[model samples]
Target: MPVATPVFDLSHIYKLSPETEDLRVYEKGQIIIEEDNGKLFPPSMTPDMGIGTCLLNERPREWRCNRANVNGAVGAVVIAIQFYRHHNYIANELHELNPCWDDERLYYTARDINIAVFTQIYFYELLPILLGKENMIKHGIISDSDGFRDMYDEDVLPQMTDEYHYALRWFHVIQEADIKMYDNDGYYLNTIPMVNVSLRTGFLPHDENLEKMTQGSFRQYGGGFDHIIDNDVSNKTVSHRLNKIRIKYSCINLT
Candidate 1:
């Protein structure tokens, strides 16, 4: 039942898989983002690229990235796009601050800053909120002090374990079926099924959905941590996939 552990394996999520390196990066430090009538979107995945599964209709709108569209939902996709934009934003700011800095320096520095920002948010913001700040601090998952702490070990290999992978799936219990939308004025607009947006990045740009969803992300309340699991989440193909993973991990000889 202990959710926090000292083991760290970023290779599964942090490191960009080899195949996606070319597709993700453009010139300089920015990730590739598509523009449609002045609006930015994730780069489109090529048809039958065979990286990850996507619906036939979604093939044209699918996002291309390190992990492709594997387990990609609207919320996850939105986060990715935000980071993509953040990277470009940082790169531009760095270029402005240091006019002499070349593309390589700009890219690497911006990338590092962008990654650090993500880590800060993940450890100091998200995890603290979810797992409790005091708990995170006690477990050594985060530090109370703002000062830098060096804990890196060259001997430790970066690899994820089956237990950690399986434990993360517990989050599905809090997955909301409805993705609520709101306007900048704090007015509720409407909601679309979270499942409907899966693998369907095309839907984001249509009718200012992206902007609304971005607003809704913070405004809308996530599913309560109660007995109720969203029907869509419980009955959908995603559930089936999770079940498969459960069975696979269950069968593993922990001994």
Candidate 2:
């Protein structure tokens, strides 16, 4: 018997349903798989952690925003550091919850974890203050205790300086401090992640394409942003000079 040709769709290829909503999905019985991308993936663990492109960090889950447990943070960091140190030549870069820290010897997992826990606290909280290292420290922006502070929390955001308002939001999202040492609310002088996109097409339907009525030329069923010709001279188009018209559609409200 000849093998039947497999019909493929999103469901056919992934052995999933058409209505599946999760962006990451695992195999029905597979033990280790990442749902980062939809497919049966092997562990992407590599000697070089792809520093330039894909990023994943092992946060102590304390510097994480919910609660602080230094010991727990140490365990997570030590595992990552040891794993990365042995395999550093392969992976591009690996970062822990804390960056650029100085502590006692990261000897064994026990030592590393202990140091890492305190480092996590200082990095997440004090590091920001240390950046200013001036009058800000006098104002309590930097403190030995990692107790949560409302002064830095993002609850009453939008009113703070643009830098900090954005910084708080960034911290909440990335779980790493975006800006360091905001004493009198001057920016720490760094770039924040903001994606800007602008797209334009140069071709407008040349000479004769618009004269004849086509499904794509009229307002009844035709044209939206780039879907229509830029030089559209029709009365229903956006540039209709003689008709001062306002369109009303139920799905939205037009002013």
Candidate 3:
């Protein structure tokens, strides 16, 4: 059965329930701080930063937004920062359009639009690669002729299967440990161990780490499509063990 895209909703990004959402708000109307224009991440005032320490030093949290999952990997944090900036940008733009809109309204409107775009990208752009554009079109997942078409189905509730998270684990095979930083002009700056920067926002402030990490986004590549997994992810990260456990317990049950 065909289901609506889950990414369009702000389901996972922010808690829909009033209880959890209330806790996320920092100021009366404003939510937690998300950096604007790829600037320095908000200071780590608490363990929510998920700052982890290593031989070099104790890394501090850079982003002060809702989630601080250190295990999400370095690339995940970088992507989050970009999305965070996007959300803030949209919020400011909405604020300009409707001066009467409170901070909460602006924030949520921005978040909704951001999630919508994110959903479009995944469904239209990313999914085509694996699911095939022709297949998607045939199945009516996407339109054959594009304008505006409503495919919204109210009956289907948003949910995920145990296999969903397990499937995302494939990224771990290609996940790189050392990320190379660069400048706007493509100048090589330095390399940092991704583990060192996890949960530590302070690493972004001391130098050009923030800018450099942003620049690295274009230059860096995940591991190749080869069947092999990086040693760090397999051994040090224990992603392999996790995968085995999931396969043994969860996937088998599904079958």
Candidate 4:
């Protein structure tokens, strides 16, 4: 059977439909569930709100953020750490620039800029790799001509097609195991199960997990493109299996 072509570019990473309204970001400067410090925490597990209290022995206080628990499998954790670092970095710059600005102002301003930067990279950088830049330009999906082209069409609804949703899942084939950790000074540290790190942000600080993960990101290579998927992915072990079952149940309810 031939698959239907997707009518929309993949924008669901940032935009959510009415059915996924809960995933929408309500705050201007923050991501959907990330805290001011850029660390994500579960709704049920909040650390003391006092200054420096969010950290346990210099590590991010741990809790179960459902997103982290279910779908965070290594790649997601890396992305989360990337964004968290970027957010804090930008916040620091903003704080230095506007000395009079309060914490909330600094946080939100940094978040807004971070999101804009992410969006720009997503379109200009990632889209080119996924869909060739020439092809995107030819299809009017993107413009080759630079400055300020507003291609916004009010007639087209901002909803993703079923084909688009299904197509996005193909990236799973490239996911790798064996997440490596390294220190800031380029020393080899230890490795952990990417799945094990999920829902345990606190551990990112323990034994220098966060610092090493951040450093190792630039130093390591992702799972190679090959004929076989990892056995863990193929088998859907433990927590992953439960996540799949829940997704299956949700799909059944939808149907």
Q: Give the alpha carbon lDDT tens digit for every residue of 1-255 in model 3.
A: 212223345443455444433323532233456443455342233565432321122323333333422223345556655555566667767767888877677766777788878777777888888679999999988877656666767786765665665576665556676788998899888887665565444455546676789888778876776666665444443123124311122222234
- Decreasing lDDT order of the candidates: 1, 3, 4, 2
Q: Residue 168 error for model 2, in Å?
A: 8.4
Greater-TM-score candidate between 1 and 2: 1
Give per-residue CA lDDT, model 4, range 12-93, as digits (tens).
2322334432332333334345443454432223345321111212234443333312223334545645654566677667
lDDT values for all models: 0.62, 0.25, 0.55, 0.51
Off by over 4 Å in 2: 1-130, 144-165, 168-255
Best by TM-score: 1
Best-to-worst order by TM-score is: 1, 3, 4, 2
Per-prediction TM-score: 0.77, 0.17, 0.70, 0.58
In order, what is each prediction's RMSD in angstroms? 5.7, 23.3, 6.2, 8.2
Off by over 4 Å in 4: 1-44, 47-71, 81-112, 146-156, 240-255
Residue 72 CA displacement from its true place in model 3, Å: 4.3
Model 1 sits at a Cα RMSD from the real structure of: 5.7
By how many angstroms RMSD does model 2 differ from the true structure?
23.3
TM-score of model 1 vs. true structure: 0.77
Q: Number of the top candidate by lDDT?
A: 1
